[model samples]
Structures are given as C-alpha cells and as structure tokens.
Target: MSENQTIYAAFAEKLDAVLSALEMEGTLPPETNRANVSVEPPRDPSHGDLATNAAMVLAKQAKSNPRALAEQIVEHLQRDPAITSAEIAGPGFINLRLAPHSWIEELSAIAARGDDYGKSAMGAGTTVNIEYVSANPTGPMHMGHCRGAVVGDALASLLEHAGHKVTREYYVNDAGGQVDTLARSVHLRYREALGEDIGEIPEGMYPGDYLVPVGKAAADEFGDRYVSEPEAEWLPLFRAFAVERMMEVIKSDLATLGIQHDLFSSEAALQAAKKPEAAEAWLREHDLVYDGVLEQPKGKTIEDWEPVELPLFRSTKFGDDQDRPIKKSDGKWTYFGADLAYHMQKAEKADALIDIWGADHAGTVKRIKAAVAALSEGQGTSIPFDVKLVQMVQLLRGGEPVKMSKRSGNFVTIADMVDEVGKDVVRFTMLTRKPEAQMDFDFAKVIEASKDNPVFYVQYAHARIRSILRKAAAEDLAPSDANLDLLAEDDLTLIKQAAQFPREVEAAARAREPHRIAFYLYDLAAAFHAFWNLGNDDAAKRIIVAQSAELSEARLFLAEQIGQVIRNGLAILGVEAVEEL
Candidate 1:
C-alpha cells in the first residue's frame, strides 16, 4: 500500500471504531452495518475535499433522518486532529475539509516518495500473463492492431508499476491453413522471381507484394530443386521460409511502434510438441476427456458436418454451451484443441492470465475460461482469466475515411501510420479511449496545434516547463523549494492537482484503464497551461523574477514536479517526452 492508501485506511478504521462505539453505547439503532462506508473526493468542490455516504447508507436501519445521523457522525469525527471540520450537507452527505497543513503534508509525502509515490502492492506479486499483438503473420500490422498493441503494452506497464509480475507475450499462429495458403503464395512469387509470367494471384491466396522478397530468397537458395517437387515436399519448407520472413517484418514493424514482447509463443511448436497430448492425458486422468460426436453448432451450417465419433473434451462440464471436439474425424486436432493447450500452458505458468484479443473472438471467451477451469479440476479453482476485446480504430485523413482494402494492395501498415503521425502522437491517440470503445483517429486532427490534439497539448505542457526552467537557469535562480508555501491560490491549485498524481496512477492501474492516465495528464496539462497563460497577462505571476529567490525556487519546484508527472505518465504509455517541441 501507498502512503495515501495507509492514510485513507487509517481514517476508515477510525470511522469504523466511532460507529462501533456508538453501537455499543446504544446511541444508534440496531442492525446498522458500516462495512460499505467509503471516503472519496466529492464531485463538487464546494462540498469539501472528501465526502462520505455513511449516514445515508445506514439511515434506514438506524431509524433516524439521514441529516440527523450525519450530524451525529460529524460531532464524533470533528474531534480527530486530522479532520479540520466535518459538515452535514444536503442528503446527509458528510463533507470533510481537512487542515491546509494536511495538503502540505501530502505534498511532502509525495516529494519523499518521488518515483515510488504511487507504487502499490495491490497485486501482491501475482503473475499476470498479457497476450497481445498476436496478429497473423500473413501481413504487416494495420491501424487496428496498433491501438491494441499500445493499449496492451501500456496496461502491462501499469500493472507492473502497480506490483504485478506481468509477462508480455505474443502468440504466433503458424500452424493454420493460412500458413498453407502463404506457402502456395510464396511458390507463385518464387516462380515470378525465376522470371516466369505468373499472372494474377489465384483466389484464396495472399496477393500482397510483401511475399515477393521471401520467394526470391527461397528460389535463390534451392533453384530447380523444388521446381518439380510435389505440394507436400515443398509446403513445409515454404511455410518455414515464409513465416521467418513474416516474423522478421513483424518485429521491425513492432519496433517502429515501440512494442517489444517478452515472449513469442509459436502455435505450431506447441502443437508439434507432446504437450497438448500430455494435457489431454491430464484431462483423461481427471475423467474430463472422452469420445463423442458434437452436435452441429447453430447459426451456421457446415456442409461437411457428418456425425462421426471423435475424441471430445467435456467443456460443458465446466460451463460451455456444449461438448467441444478435441480432434476432427480426420484424426487431426481442431483449432479449439490447440487453444485448450495454450490456455493450459498459461494456467500452469502464471497465476492469472489476461488475453488481449480482437473483437472477432468475443464468442471464444466462455469456452476458453471453461477449458481452463475444467483442466484445473478446482484446485487452482477460480481461474481468473480476463479477455479484453479492443474495438476497431477507424483511420481518417482530412475528415474522410482512408481507403485501405487489402485486396487492392493498399492497406495501411502500422509503420505507415506511425510514420505519418509520429510515434508520440500515435501512442497518445491510441490510448485516448478505452479498449472496449471503438475509436476514431483523424490524421489531420491529431497533428493540429490545438487543444483537440491531446498529444500536442500535453507535450506542450512539458515543453513549456522546460522553457520556464531554461529561463530560471538563465536568471541564476535555484530550482529547489526553499519556501514552497509562498504559492498563491492559483499556484497552489496547480500544485494540488499535481499532488493527485500518485493517486491517479494507482486508480488507473487498479481499474486496468491506461486511458485514464492519458486523460488525467491532459487535465493536468490544461491546468498548467491556464496558469502559464495567467502569467502572460500579469507579469508578477511569472515563474521567475528578480526578488525573493526562495519563492522563485519554490514555484520552480512545483513546475519540476508537474514535469516529472507528465514524464512518468508518458513513459508508462511508451510515448517520448521531449524537452523541446
């Protein structure tokens, strides 16, 4: 827990004690529970710093008017030294106005904590596996994958910062029919590299020019050897060559977006291993594996749905809609079977798993969780697996949707998007919205030099601080806080906002929403900008002046604090915070 957490917890304990004392003395009615009481910042500033709903929540059982109960609660709380005053407001809301010294003390605590200010043990060293950017190696990532990549990376960073042992992983699905198609496509490219005509691409094959180079290398390596070979003879070789090139391109593309994974698990390697068989063996030992025929799924009819008995997994035993197939009638494991093994690996390696998947896989959520639960056999019982579906990103340019049809060979790659907007703007805009909500990224709007461009607005705030620091250094003023209390109302408003940085980080981390950090930084930057503009109107409000070097140092100290918060926030999101525009 953090200092803020410690303080709030102590306050809650004291409040609980007060309620217990009242209950024991029979000053309150019976059966009034106090467990749900909470202290949080009020929505309205005039209501005071923190507000509690204790009286309102407990009023019915106490058989007293909420305001009366609030008054009784306030009389007891006002005796505490930490609380300056407690007022019973409308609707029995108990509003607290802490001593100004308390705010100063919080600021001091922040200064003492420094970079560790918002660190928390909320996760308690639990392991969380975050799988993201498992984009098919068919082609380079597009704008849609970019948003998920940034969101996942930022979320992992936030989780780690909040005390979870996080593993950033990328799943490579190289065993699917898509790889077979890629192999054939590369063959055509190899023929083309041999100066063959190789007309239009066949249907159901990759048409992108990206595979041309891979084909050329393959042809150079084994000129006429595979020219007359059968499909089976060349398919595996072609797949290996194509996937290696695809992974290389993917690594470069991810580098452009500043994303690096801790692990890149290959589906083919896992399938080829005896692991899934071992997993099946484990399930068999638990009596969860059997032979059965699955009824055809509704909503879609498979033309080849012949009722044939096959090895099945008792997924419905855990809570799936029905029993699922582990192997097809052809004696090959189905895609879902491979997924079961992957999840089993996750369950064995980590205490918790978080899969960042595309919205298209939303229906797979229940079955995946069910498989993990069934496989664990109630030992690692409540398998806390969460799936985050990152909605699509509509890319726009000049107020019009950018046309990107892959069939036309004009799809936007992540590299192109990052190059157009630059990495900082790309990272910031991608995080400006929650993963659950679809986002719109207007290329024109993001590059604009206005408030609508959150990236520029926030970066400008940091740049302005650097500018002020430059001015301070040129004027030979110290940056330390010799007399930070000299801050005026406007100055202290900015300082107080900065003081909320640690709390904001903790909240954003716990909520698993890094976008909250982005939004908070924008709000903080707006506050600093308003303060900076005020100084432009009145010169005495300037950050640096000729007299009272100690006061100047104090204001500079506040500016440095604001800059540090912005820097840390941007760093978590993997955006660069440059000192100059």
Candidate 2:
C-alpha cells in the first residue's frame, strides 16, 4: 500500500474488490448500494484485528442468508496472503486477523509519513466556514467563551487536517445594545481618568477594570473635548472607540490561548451594507416573511400585554415552535433577523457553515436553522449548516467553586485561566468531554501528576518515549526499522493502536467533533504504557535489551513511530508534546 493510504483504507479497498468479485460471479446483484457497509476495529478487541458488516448489510439485497453471504465473502478474503484468517462471528459479522507483517508495514508507513500520517483527504473539495468565540465586543474574553473557542479552533485545525479548505471566522457583535452599555461604562472610566470622582459604577454598566486602559487612552488622546460634549455627539464616537479597544483586548486574550481568526465580521458592517434589508425583502417576496401579530409571551404574567404587528419569518413552516419576528416594534432588526443575514452571508462564501455557540443560545437554534433551510431552498442549493452548542465550564480551585475575577468583576478571564494553567492544559481540559456536557475545571485536579489527568498522562507518555530514545542515542544506538522482523507480538499490538489514528481523524471530522482526537490519544497512551510496563516484570521484554541490539533497534523504531503519532495528534488539538517531563 502507498504511504498515504491508511491500513483501514487499504482493507476497505480490498473488501470492495472481494465484493466486486462476488458480483462478477453472479452471487450478488450488480450496482448494489453498499453505503451502510463499515470497516472498523471490533468493539471487543479479542474478536479480531478488523471487522466489517458487508455481508450483513447486503444480504437482503443479494437474496441470500447473511451467514451464507459471509461464508462466500470470507472465502475470497482468506485468499489474500496478508489476511491470516477470516472468521464469521455471531450472525454475519466478518472478523479478519491479519498477519503481523501487515501491522509492521503500517508502522513503516507511520515512520514514512511522519506528521502527515493521520491526515486524510476525506474533506477534499469542501470549503467550511467556522464561526466561533464571537463574544460580544464589550470586554475581554471570559471563561464562558473559552470552551467554545478551544472546541472551534481545534475543530478548524481538525477539518484542515482532514483536507478541507477552512475559514476561521469571528463575528464581532459591535452593533448590539451591549456595546452602547460598554460605551457608557468607558465614559465613566474616562471621566475618572480625567481625575473626576465618578464614584461607584452605575447599576447597569460594566465594572471591569480591564477597560481602564481604554478609558485612560481615550482621555489622553481626546483631552476632555468629548468629556463635555452632548450624549448624542459622544455616544457614537465612544462606542466605536471602546469596541475597537475591547476587540484588541479580546484578540490578545485569544492569542494567549494560541487562537487567531482569519476574519472578524462586524454586525455593524453587515447592517451598514444593508444585508438584512435585502434578506427581509427576498423573504417577503417569497412569502416566508409577512406582517403578523404574535400571541402573548408565555410563562410570564404581563399585566399590560398588547399585540403589535411585526414582520415575522414563517419559521413554523420549517419545524420551529413558532414564527419568529425579523423586526421589532421600533423598526430595528431583531438579533435573529441580523443573524439570519449573517448566516446567509457566510453561506455565500463557503459550501458549509458551522457555528460554535454557547448553550445559552440553545433556544434560538431552531429558528436560525429554519431560516437557513428556507434560504438554501430558495437559492436552489443544499448548504450543510450546523450549530454546535457548547455547555458551560464551572471553575474550581480546590474542590470549591472559584470566585469571580477582580479584573473582569463578573467572571474569570481567559488570560487569567491561561496564566494559572498553561495553554495546553486549558485547551486539552476543555476538550476532555463532549462539548454539550457540563464540566468542572478544577485547578488542583487538572494539574495533578497522575494517570487520571489526561493532559499530563498523554504528555508524559511522549516524554517517556523521548527519554527512551535519548538513553539509547547516548549509548551509540538509534532507531532502525531494518530489524522490524525481530519485533514481538506485544510490539505489534501497539502498532495496531497507533494505526487507528487515520480512521479516527476521518470519523471525527465527519461527526464534526474534535474531542475524539483527545480520547484516542488517551487510549493510545494507555496502550503504550501497558506495553512499557511489561518490561518491568521481565528485562528481556524491555525496549533496550542489551543482549540483543537487533531487538532493541526494532523496538526503538516502534517507539519513535508511536511518539510521532502522539505529536501529530497533539498538533491537531493545539497542544504541545513536551520532549521531556
């Protein structure tokens, strides 16, 4: 097999050949739909090295019993020299045990491909636009935004590794009411910078000390000219100034976490360009938008509720609970209205769109999805869109919920988290669980030097491998695949574990979940550690067998490839694989 072709891919192709041979001999119908057939490692490792469900999925179509079909398929599969045995298990599952040389060849491929071993062309010819970490441009990034940021950024890298053209995007919500509040807050700070006693912050304004620099900078630049101006005259100027500076702070915080977006789309710019107006007009023309009055709000008693005619999108036609308003009573666009246009704009630039949003936005996902579906149908194209809701991360220091930061006042800033725990720890910890599940980020637990801590465990595995290599190098020994034939079954076991990287990459990319990479690395590390422990009981099982240089070289080569795979996985996760502990 070519170095670029993964072992699973090679076997998948071989399986296809066997199926085709069966077709040619009139055992199965020609042009059968084999989309449901899958090739993967069986859930029970003792079952076999690889398993496929071809006979089971195709039996009904082929007009034969599944076990009979499996018998025929196994006959063709066992003919291949690389396949040591093909067994029919339970009902119709075909499990193939491969010769050890096949896995040894995969280890050689891992060494040949190096960093590009697990990368695949599965997403080739696709352009994905991923918008993430779009915290309102009013303050520094906080812990609330950290999880989605890491998830989105890692997913972008994962998709890129899977061969997709990806655009990392951030939506700057500078046009919202929040920025106006930010402007007023900065004004108070600016007054304080001019030595005025502004007193305690007002009830409805941001109190973060992080904005003090923006206030002081404004005072030094403008020199009290805006200090005396009317609210109307200064609101626009201060709002723009504060947003620009706050975005700088946000960018810097993201930088500390090793994140940078290719595009920072501004809601104000989108509005100024009249994109929402155009979308409203198009939807209105197609009867998707109409002047309608909504029922009274639910679950709350409104003493003076009154009906008002609004331009509402017919989201109910596409699975939403109710039709949604595109415009408010005051002739301004609703958040959904603007967001719909934003997604439409993104859809124009890419074949698929993914939005990483906080769990708080879960209520609006349906309306937005409905809008995208309607718009895509109107445009005569099928654009795949997904909104991934990331749940909150509760911060803890010592088994107790951590208090809010003094700088941000409301929450822990991303900078503070990065400063407390390194970037790799924060990033890897955020992805340890599925994004939809709530997690606790306990400082004491995260940094613990034990196998229970995934970051430390995976990093230590790479470090231990490097330590092995260094000790061997100092003794005039280097990794040599020339003696791989001397490797034992235990060594090939680790190779089988490492060989799953490519399959995992494709599967994770298809599911749009980057957490799988972290999970896979942990398992791979456990397998390596298990093999390493075997040497503890018997010195001959060790990687560096002084009595046999050939076995040592072969084992060292295996160790080197395992380290390479770890480095590649960590790279996708934006984590560092330290060479030493």
| TM-scores for every predicted model | 0.90, 0.99
What total of clashing residue pairs does each candidate reach? 0, 0
lDDT against true structure, model 1: 0.82
Which candidate number would show the highest TM-score if scored against the true structure?
A: 2
- Candidate 2 error regions (>4 Å): 299-303
Question: What is the TM-score (0 to 1) of candidate 2?
Answer: 0.99
Considering every candidate listed, which one attains the maximal lDDT? 2
- Over 401-482, each residue of candidate 1 has an lDDT whose tens digit, in order, gives 9987453276888888887788889989999988889888899999999998899999999999998899889888757756
Write down the lDDT of every candidate, Cα atoms only. Answer: 0.82, 0.94
Q: Which tens-of-lDDT digit does each residue in 1-581 have in candidate 2?
A: 88789899999999999999999999989998889998999999898999999999999999999999999999999999999999999899999999998999999999999999999888986999999999998889999999999999999999999999999999999997899999999999999999999988999999989989999999997899888788899999999999999999999999999999999999999999999999999999889999999999886467778789999999999999999998899999999999999998998999999999999999999999999999998999989999999999999988899989999988899999999889999999999999999999999999999999999999999999999999999988899999899998899889999999999999999999999999999999999999999999999999999899989999999999999999999999999999998
